[model samples]
Target: MSILNSFLIKTSSVKKICISFFASQFTLLIMMLYTFPIINSQIGTRAFDLQNLGYSLSTANQIVNNLNNQTTELYLFPQLTLLDVFYPFLLALFLSSLLFRLGKLIGKDNKITSLLLYLPLLAMAFDYFENICIILMISKSIEISKSFVLLSSTFTVLKSLLTTFSWIVILIYTIKWVRLKIMKKATKSSLSQS
Candidate 1:
């Protein structure tokens, strides 16, 4: 909590920090996109295909059983779930700040603004839980527990929903910000001409 408070204090009014976070997200996206295909090729349909099969012990076991020995041994490398935790963590901070800034641009009421500012934390929190669960499942390999798979799947669903909601809100606020900027510029130009 103190760390969160400190981060909020440090980043609250710093537009550059928020922008940097977005930039990092873009880079992360590219890296993940590139690596996922490579991992998919090596592991075949094990990772993502099983991920789509819903959250269950059966699904988890299937995924675990499908793992190649080499992939299982080299688990943390190239596809580092431990280090990947930072992506969603930083995303929650930067995205919330961006949404809050955008909300204010269109004169959103304080209640709405406050919700926008804090809501991304839900996504981030779930993402961390999901990561932990995935790591556990991976470490266990063929012996992965059904309970862990169920837990990870639940967290994945939650993280997906919250992340989608956060992005939707950000999109709405961004559109509002753009419209407001255009309107304000038009109003100023008219005044100058008169």
Candidate 2:
């Protein structure tokens, strides 16, 4: 109950809205993981191998598809097109900020905001690692060694979840901001009392 009160009362000095956004985004990522397979199953096998290549996986395909009249003989799967609009670096930053806001709402300003700041860096690293995987997969230069289908699926789901979580965090941050702004006059008066 005390914890709930802290979240709802809007009495803190910190940037509560920003914190709320961060927390929400993290949760959203988890939820996205649970849901994306249902939404973009066409990528199927390719989605797994392509996950590391960032938005390039989908965008590169679009370039290929446009260049040729029909199937240009590359069988790398077309559904990577699903990610053409969602550039991974930009998406990771946006989602991180959103998650930061969510964390603020629940009185977790410092840690959440710090995480938000760092996630982009991590996203970059993770993305690069995934890209290496994609390259290896593409050239047949290296054997996957494990269950290709299941392994790729697992990674795809996790990646998608992380992306979704970013958006959720931002939404939560926005919510907290609105709540505080609506109560600004009262908040000011209370501060004057202290």
Best-fitting candidate, scored by TM-score: 1
Regions of model 2 farther than 4 Å from truth: 1-86, 97-108, 119-124, 147-152, 185-194
Q: Please, what are the lDDT tens digits per residue for candidate 1 over residues 1-194?
A: 34544465566576755575876677477546755555556655545322533467775666566667677544455455643555676778787766655665688846756765666788778777776666666667435666666767877777777777888988988788888889999999999999
RMSD of candidate 1 to true structure, Å: 3.6
Candidate 2: tens digits of C-alpha lDDT, residues 78-190: 21222321335444544454454456564656644555545543554454445445445544556544454334434544565555555565566677777777788788989
For each candidate, the alpha-carbon lDDT, in order, equals: 0.66, 0.45
* lDDT: worst 10-residue window of model 2: 71-80
> What's the TM for model 1?
0.77
TM-score of each: 0.77, 0.45
Candidate 1 residues lying further than 4 Å off, grouped into runs, are 1-9, 12-19, 26-34, 46-54, 141-147
lDDT for model 2, please.
Answer: 0.45
